[model samples]
Target: MFYFFFESRGNQTDPVVIWLTGGPGCGSELALFYENGPFHITSNLSLSLNDFGWDKVSNIIFVDQPTGTGFSYSSDDRDIRSDEEGVSNDLYSFLQAFFKEHPQFVKNDFFITGESYAGHYIPALASRIHQANQKNEGIHINMKGFAIGNGLTNPAIQYKAYPDYALNAKLIQQADYDMLQQKVSFCEQATKPCGNQSNAKDSCDKAYNVCGEIFNDILAIAGDINYYDIRKQCEGLMCYDFSNVETFLNQDPVKKALGVGDIEYVSCSTTVYQAMSADWMRNLADGIPSLLDLGIKVLVYAGEYDLICNWLGNWRWVDELVWSGQKQYAAAKNGSFMVDGKDFGLQKGFGPLSFLKVYNAGHLVPMDQPKPSLEMISRWTKGLPL
Candidate 1:
């Protein structure tokens, strides 16, 4: 694993947060430079301080993982992970080694966080650490909780919400929504088998293929709008471009400073993404109830404008979660999410679980609303209300 660690600019006692970007294969550098990292790339490729960087409130680590993603690579093909077990195990092993080398940060409260597909990664990794700690495994990590922003955690439930989200967002008409219901029903039926432990990889892959049509249908109807944020149109193949990130990292001076030398930076590995296709429809939410039972905090926040991995899906899964606090959480009314005395969103939380619907933002909340996102992290890590 290749990671960039930035210590807290506030207090040394601040929590340590490990951030993972989605794509199942996207490098964490996307978030590091474009979202919530300590710096942003300038037009001239110079580094400029991100005023609302998470490191201002806590120590943050950006990791490129699962091998062959970003700056990390492995000679063995077996190192590529297709499922949460393999993914979580690799991260768990990294944490043990990391804590051993830097014992000082081991005692600090640790947090797992990320966006997009990290919805799957964060919970699985948190569950891995929780189980290991209960069993008295190597290196008892002082884990606090986890947070996900616009992530696709429970694909079955999330996939089903596609048509409803489209309808509610005014992206589709009543007639189009009524038409999409068939696709939604098909996705739901196909995805059910994926939740079964005895299911074959072929079954999961089939489910992924079937359920993907729901989003495909939406995109076909919605035109060129960015799936990450419906409010924006894609510039090319991507809604937002970070070509400068590639250009900057490939520079000899930058490579030498980072000590990566001549190793090519693989921005997004198609090999790893294709390998993990079968794992896409599996419900990662199955492991969260156990972690919640152990009193591990969870925060699921979403940007309202995101079509894929929309707020509606995340809210549905979190609300329908079969946990001890499910009733209280369901009964709880949303409160204003204030930043500097202005309401930026709505928050619903009870006990160890929280859900936020950020206003006027998209899939990448920090990039869309930096100050509010930073305040969100500050409040979340401190166990304070939003």
Candidate 2:
């Protein structure tokens, strides 16, 4: 189960947004003191208030998912192994237990949102929440919808789009792009069948390895470019500068302040990573069409400049999803995403779903462009268009 909680400073009536960061291993703590949380770390390594935190418009929950992420730990190693089933099931249990303890929030409008691998977590977990709501099961959560940020939902379309993304970004020469282009069809073929839930683990794993190589080598030419953002030098997780966060978290005083006991905090857990990757190639896009059909609003927004889970690939998959309004959704033109009355991104919506291509952000939108990211989330969560 997940652990810890970070409540936002806002009106009690605000909708609750459960935020999950996508490392498959990275804990929510990354999102807590950084990203969309109420506070951010300063240059001197002290914390400062973020006026644009998502907490301004909604309450947020950032939990260490699986059994061993962040402060979440278990005596049994088996508890650490997290596949899609464990993530979705444990999150469902967590919500039930969470709402039980905090009964006042049970009926409040709830939204699930996250970035990166959370593309997998949000959809799978949202499906469970919706199903439970249908059965009028325990808690009867006021489940509204979910949003994913630069997530990995569909591999076939995404994998095929890599060469074009790199080429269009002008990262590679024409000859190199032409050479890489030949490999896409086969790679996409490998990814296409692997998304099926019925596919065997070995089969899916092999496909991910085969097709994922397309984007994996994007930086091979540049040699030092950040995979998260081709716009910057590779600077490690959190863009290297936030190494202080790891330092601060490891301190005795900070640990005690957060009620984290004797356990040492790691930004990411290898055990959780391995477990989540077992079926990493599984087609998460399978759940989207149905989830949308249930009247659950889905927001898939990607930062325009990201190399890993880039906006082009995210848009491709959304356009490819089959649903009741597929044709209409496909034909819809993008509307300017405004922040502070200024255009900041582009959004296209149909059938309770929308896709936004945020400008100049990367894999972590909040970290790169915090103000715009905050406005984007606040507006969208309130049923505002983009």
Candidate 3:
């Protein structure tokens, strides 16, 4: 069984949302404390309430996935699914059991959400859920929509936007900027094989090595800066010291409370990352149009200041999506995203598709601007304007 940390207001009228974190291995335990989950990690290394938690708007399940991540583990190494398809199948089964165990939530409207690598996970899982919903493949879920923050949905095209994003953000000089433009061609060529699932695993491995060099080039120029947030410099050993999270979860009391015995805890799993390496560069954007066509809502939000999966690339891919309202969606005017009478960000969306450019935020938008993030989810989940 997967380790799922469930939180609810117990309001039967509200929707249920399953939240996943990226890394293909970054367990949702990180999301539970670090992002939109109810708790905060205090200086005392204990849990505190987050006023802007996503649970306020819906019943949320924070899952530690991929069979070997966080508290969720299996003795069989092959039990883990390295690709997006296996991950989705595992989650689908987990959800089936989850609803069976708690039948009260079965009828509630449901949604799936995640960030970073989940860009790929969300679309893949959504497709599976969509298929299940249509074919009666499993217990019917009132699947509503999906939201991704600073996700890597379309790495192939998103990679092309990085050089321009750096230039526009003033992170690179004209000489360096031109160099990035020159590298874009090589990066795209190298990324081709990995862009499709039909290619050999070796080709995908090659794409990661070849295309990743472009990012490495940018990192060389912008030394000691946070790739997740360009406005900030790298913090401590791991860019941001989540050591406390690792430390906190490892406490005996916490482990006992979580019901996972004797298993080691980590914020992310390196083994899972290596297993998922080949699927990393494959384009998830290809799945979005079909998802939208299925009438499943797609909300892609990005932090304006992030460098890794920057806003430019996110917006570009959303606009590139082919659908019934292609022209109107592209021409839709961006409006201020207001919170407490203050303009927090700008949003432009139409029909079931929407994209928000979160101002003054980074890769983890909720961690950066919690109130606005909450408002964004609450709005989209309720069919409110983007």
**Against the true structure, whose lDDT is highest?**
1
Q: List, residue by residue over 99-143, the lDDT tens digit for candidate 3.
A: 888898888888999899899888888888888988987789898
RMSD of 2: 1.7
Q: List the residue pairs that clash in candidate 3.
A: none
Compare the candidates by TM-score and give the number of the best one.
1
TM-scores for candidates 1 onward, in order: 0.98, 0.95, 0.97
Q: List candidate 2 stretches off by more than 4 Å.
A: 1-8, 237-239
**Scored by CA lDDT, what does every candidate get?**
0.89, 0.81, 0.86
Superposition TM-score, candidate 2 onto the true structure: 0.95
Q: Summarize candidate 1's per-residue lDDT along 1-386 as a digit string, tens digits.
A: 88899999998889999999989898989899998999999999999999999999998889898777898888899999988888999999988988887788888999999998898888889989988998999999888899999998899999989989998888888999888888888888888778834346988998999999989988888888998999889775557787888898889998999898688775678988998888888888888887887788899999999998999999999999999999999999989999888999999999889999999999999999999999999999999987
Worst-scoring 10-residue span by lDDT in model 1 = 191-200
Q: Which window of ten consecutive residues has the lowest lDDT sum in model 2?
A: 1-10
Q: Candidate 1 or 3, higher TM-score?
A: 1
Model 3 worst lDDT run, 10 consecutive residues:
1-10
Candidate 1 stretches with Cα past 4 Å from truth are 196-199
lDDT of 2 by residue, 85-186 (tens): 777888889889998988877767899999998988888898888888788888888878899999988877777778888989888777877777667766
Clashing pairs counted in every model? 0, 1, 0
The TM-score ranking, best first, is: 1, 3, 2
Report model 1's TM-score to 2 decimal places.
0.98
